[model samples]
Target: MKLTQIDKVYGKKHVLKNVTLEFPAGKITVMVGPSGSGKSTILRSLNLLVTPESGQYDFNGHQIDFSQKLSSKEKLAIRRETGMVFQDYNLFPHKTVLNNVIEGPTQVLKMGRKQASELARELLAKVGMADYGDVYPNELSGGQAQRVAIARALAMKPQYLLLDEPTSALDPELELSVLKVLLQLAHEKQSMVLITHNMAFAKQIADKIVFIEEGQVIYDGGPEEFFSADNPNGRIKNFIASMTMENLR
Candidate 1:
């Protein structure tokens, strides 16, 4: 997927300023930056949850103009191609884990109940949540809930998985379970765009890293180059160092 000259504004604040980015197929691209830097906004734009004020969004063979109002068909097409996972596990509290996972498939994709159940169970097992299929969202720990959320997103078989701080809501110990599932997904070559503050975790699994600040991309490169002296931008180095300091404290 590719985005070019994307721009967004919220009142007096210009959140995304002429942002351009590319996510290569079957790779993990991690977005990192300070809070309110528009990292999440970019992810939201990709999922069409927040349309850009003006720009081009390209996915598969579709090149959508954000400058114009998209038809309902166009919005649905973009959503069908991308799956989004949020910081909070937006599960139906009344539904069992399995039910939550299968809902999209049965409702949106029009899959039969048996098939959707089968697929949901398979995904649950993949995320190490098989045993919790009968459990309610409120009964599971934060980590387990997020794992189920991941499984739910995967049920759609989207072309690109977009995540906004999937581990941010969890404690340090709980973060591991969700990160492990993400690592497994990375190993399986699932194309993804992740917005995260966990720099260490991001460095571990990212195939490419994009650093943004104050609504503009400052650095875009491989992990090795991003961490090494090859990165001529001193700002990223300082940012990483500051994050490291915070982690130590």
Candidate 2:
């Protein structure tokens, strides 16, 4: 997926400024930055949660011009190609885990109950939540809820998965559980764009690292070169160092 010359504005505030990014298929690209730096906005824009004011977006044979208003069919097509997971898991409170997972496939995709239920169970099992299918979302822990959320997103079989702070609400130990699942997905060559403050996690799993600050991208490169001694991007280096120190505290 590629986005070119993207720009976003909220009244007088410029949230994203001329942003261009490439998300290589079958690899993980991580976006990290201080809060409110437009990282989530970029992720949201990819799936059109928040449309950019101007840009070119290309994904899986569909190309969109942000300058023009998209028809309903165009919007649905774009959404069908991408799946998004939010920070809070965003599960339906009254729905059982099985129901939540099957809702997308049965409703939007017009899948039959038996097939969607079978897929939902398989996905829940994949995420280690097979036994919790009948339970409500409020009954699960943060990590468990997030896993269910992931399963729900994967049920759509989207071309790409977009995650915003997937594990931010969990404790360090709990975060590892979610991270382990994500690492497994990475190994399976799932294409994803992740936004997180976990520098260590980014270093461990990111195929490409993107650093955004003040509504602009400051660094975009491979992990090895990004942390190498010879690299001269002081802002990113300093940011990583500070995050590391905080993690230790």
Look at candidate 2 and tell me the lDDT of residue 87. Answer: 82
Tens-digit lDDT track of model 1 for 27-80:
999999999999999999998899888999999998899989988888888888
lDDT of all predictions: 0.93, 0.92
List pairs with backbone clashes in candidate 1: none
Residue 110 CA error for candidate 2 (Å)? 0.6
Candidate 2 is scored at a TM of: 0.97
Deviation from native of the Cα of residue 112 in model 2, angstroms: 0.6
Clashing pairs in 2: none
Worst 10 residues of 2 by lDDT: 240-249
Error of 1 at 159 (Å): 0.7
* TM-score for each candidate, following the candidate numbering: 0.97, 0.97
